[model samples]
Target: MKEPYEKPLIKKVQVGLSNKFGSVYGRHLRPEIDGVPISDLVSRFGSPLFVFSERRLREKYRQIYQMFSTRYPNVQFSWSYKTNYLDAICAILHQEGETAEVVSEFEYEKARRLGVPGSEIIFNGPYKPLSALKTAVQEGAIINIDHFDEIYDLEEIAEELGQPIKVGIRLNMDTGISPQWTRFGFNLESGQALDAAKRLVSGGKLILNGLHCHLGTFLLEPRAYAKAIEKMVDFAYELEDNFDLKIEYLDIGGGFPSRNRLKGIYLSPEVAVPPLEDFAEAICDTLLSKLKPNDFPKLILETGRAIVDEAGFLITTVHASKRLPDGTRSYVVDAGVNILFTAFWYNFKIELEEDISGPAEPCVIYGPLCMNIDVVAENVQLPPLPRGTRLIFSPVGAYNVTQWMQFIRYRPAVVLVGEDGQVDVIREAENLNDVVDRERLPERLILKKS
Candidate 1:
């Protein structure tokens, strides 16, 4: 009896405003990135691999640089290290002439180890220990004072070192943007930022050269930047008038959105996110109008996410697929929130390597972690992706690697595909020894069991 096998089928009731067609498998879709097949990458590097494209990184950097440089004559980009501190990524930015913007002493040391001069590094964030501040001040790094205490700390350090240091004051302003980030810097509206400047000038311990402000992360509206630029210009003028100080540079700080769609967002990122030109235009237009040609200060931009997010791809394999008791489909994959931390906030777009055609059903992707919160995608419409199927998650080049937690499994290797299609392992996969190497064992606790 030679009977043909038939696939098992299940029906799902569509919910509110569902895309019934699911992912359209069309002729234009090919699962090759940078001319290399996804299957080949998986087979060679192993599943749950992180692939970064050098071409994409360079292209994005150049695009952003051109966009801002064409408008502002003295535009400088400082790569924010906390976003993605992989040495390879930082090296690329350094090679492309980007200074490093580090928030911690560890990150500051990392930049120095990478041969980034102290003068080129922008040391930010609160909680810079006295030791770190002394090193930064002595090494000539641009330290942006976060609060009054930091100003006092720098004053003490300047006194101890017997050398006056140049510094910038991080300002917090009301730009009419929702959910303002007031925790980082001095408040501008309340005149606290001006007071900080006055203190610095009166102390004769630090040289105030720059004004820094980071509005927020993942900013989508360009108008917010416009308003912030206007306020910054006005504030700089006021500081110059009050303290008789010339602002050397204005650090707008990074908040540019990538192409990853937020979890609660209905529309895809491509449609929702504004182009890079919009942000540049908003900032450049405001600066050009406010400052005279003779008074143009060097513009510093700390662009982290927008420069590298689209260049990263995560390749994971589907380990198991099953139907829940409630008639909903579920997929278990090797990658989880432990590794792909951005999954908690972003609904990352997943693509299948092979052609999948059938009645697409809504499925929830679960990571291999045992925790209840280890979900990757809440609800994505996809066709039947059985066991051993490979799926690629895109635009994950930002915070995932830097903030990934090492809980259950070892972190995987990260490979960078060169412009010539040559793949190199930039970060090797961690082993059990790598995880436990830093542990200390007590002799009294080391006993042999019978």
Candidate 2:
């Protein structure tokens, strides 16, 4: 006979959550169902956690790749490493058969460690150390030289090695983009680009591969790229005619806009930016019309933000909330400008995770940092949020992690949410020991401590 079981006591927990905009999730801004909560993650790993959605990442990658591949015969995406160089992110892109565009030797080494072939990698940027240039050349990477100094350096290195090194020149054209004439590549009107090409062809140590140029970042205008392509094709034609060398690839450097919303921009994601199809059509039409059918160079795009921006979400817990003397409410979170550097340029829409019926009110969001410039959001209308509430900041997957500063605090862990909604910690939160691992103690200080 089974013994009678005692009545089990039930406990009810009440938790109120809210955002300034009166938007909330059913409970909290949990990244995954049946997965770890922000609070629990902080308990185990700490606060200011960055969570990447693997599903979103793969989806975005496929969308961008398909957008170009479906329209253009030959299209390749070289992931921009400087955007976000997290090993896990790089590995994911590499696993997807995406090539890499590295600006420095360190990033080149990183790509090599990920098993990416140097031939598939495109070495770009204005300033590459001698060691980096030597390594890239020895590895047979497509070196996109930025200026005449770089050209001279490559020539010197090649002469020293007693071999011809293949390289490309970055052309700066009047793409009609904002902040125009920024110091970077060779300007088209200045004749410097032509001079550089001439010097490369005349020099026996260098092999001119192709032309490269990036107008600018966050470029909403597709026509700019179209015009830029027109100029690049003309330059390529000139190089072929002048040097009798066929350009193998035309690397249109990456600056494609991500899903993030910019300040003072009212357009939504659907209409604000031109679709990848538009860019592909422009580039393909321009190149196909300009170059002979047999001379069509392999089109390469070094996209960073558009490929990975939507893939990441930064989740933080509300530490405290208080009403100011001026009757304004201020909410403090575990994250700040350190990790969300893009917040300086964007108005990050923070969403609440719980449902609540309340009028929206203007509130200031502050990070845990003590600096006055550490404000994340100010004078933004938000739903009332109390302490212990979790908030979700979407579309932070691009420049945040790469540009984040470890000021007044250690950085947080980065987790990847799998397709099945399972969470895996891709990067562990930094500990005190991590900050001091390389630090050496003086004998006097050590003696005092002892």
Candidate 3:
């Protein structure tokens, strides 16, 4: 009889960096999520499923809320819809007393359908069509004006409606951050922000109720927010003195960094990112010192990723394994960049569902797409994972669902595990009809096979 079959293996000399640098296993353990085993979840929901923890979501929201509210009076949080707009996730935050912060008309409509009052919604972003504006205005939404055209449009709308409309001016300032986000709002350094405020207040068509500025996304430095708050408060005081306007709220747009390691980062996220309380202290310290006790404006934060990223997980299964010509191990998984868009920039934390002991080797994880750019992780240290091994990719709740692409594969179902450990499908998995239903072919093309 022939010798027992064994998978081909290569023995190579260890060189250069040690395995400890690249290997993430043995240090991190992932046996279950919310007391639900990974195998059970895969069996029940199918492989390549997106799982969200309602308990973690509520915990993070409460943690962040307490961190800020305890430091600053009149603190409010608006769930950033662009981060993760899953109805269940949004509902959880809304239930925790968080308002809705939407960017597009679709998000605005979703908030409304979710029973979020228009007045409680903060309608943001650069593009606001006339119809959306009309709806938002009539619904009592707080619109943050982006550019001069918006000011003129709002003035026209106010004139047409025969009443002065309240709006916030998004001011762009140099907060000493790299690649400044100056494209969205009026430049404060150039006095354009002051000019816009004057245009709104002096014109008597629009009322400037709030001041808003978004520094940048995934900001590693809390001091940047300190700078932003300082400038925003100074501008608010100037507006009150010169324009006789009482700014109702100071909206500091979301830039809080999440606990996800970037692709090029060498240190882990737990080592790199500042704690949530640190950010709170930085912001609150600035606000408390800058504003007088009687003039403290309502502090509104639009934090999204920092609040939800850690609460989500992506469970994928290994479909196949192979060795490259150079004896490098490679894993082909059921999910890829199509669903995990953040994989392009983040080296997401991945964990094996079961414990196994073996010599760890450099591995590249690829998605089940025909494209070559669908790599999920590169040069990660992992032992050989045979076919069907489950891998959990985590801190994925922020942008994956909202930014996922519908190319090649239909998106997977998203399930939310409630606090009581009950699993519910928040978003149904897409099927062939889901893709074809929205697509139309002309009658002539349908009749003739071209």
Winner of 2 and 3 under TM-score:
3
- Model 1 spans with C-alpha error above 4 angstroms: 1-10, 13-30
Candidate 3 or 1, higher lDDT: 3
Which residue pairs in candidate 1 collide? Answer: none
User: Per-residue lDDT of 77-136 in model 3, one digit per residue for the tens?
Assistant: 999999999999999999999999999999999999999999999999999998899889
- Per-prediction RMSD in angstroms? 2.7, 7.7, 2.4
Specify the poorest-scoring 10-residue window by lDDT in model 3.
Answer: 18-27
Highest lDDT: which candidate? 3
TM-score of each: 0.95, 0.89, 0.95
Across 95-170, the per-residue lDDT of candidate 2 in tens digits comes to 8879999988888998899789888899888789988888888888998888888988998899989999888888
Error of 3 at 256 (Å): 0.8
Give lDDT for model 1.
0.89
Q: What is the full ranking by TM-score, best candidate first? A: 3, 1, 2
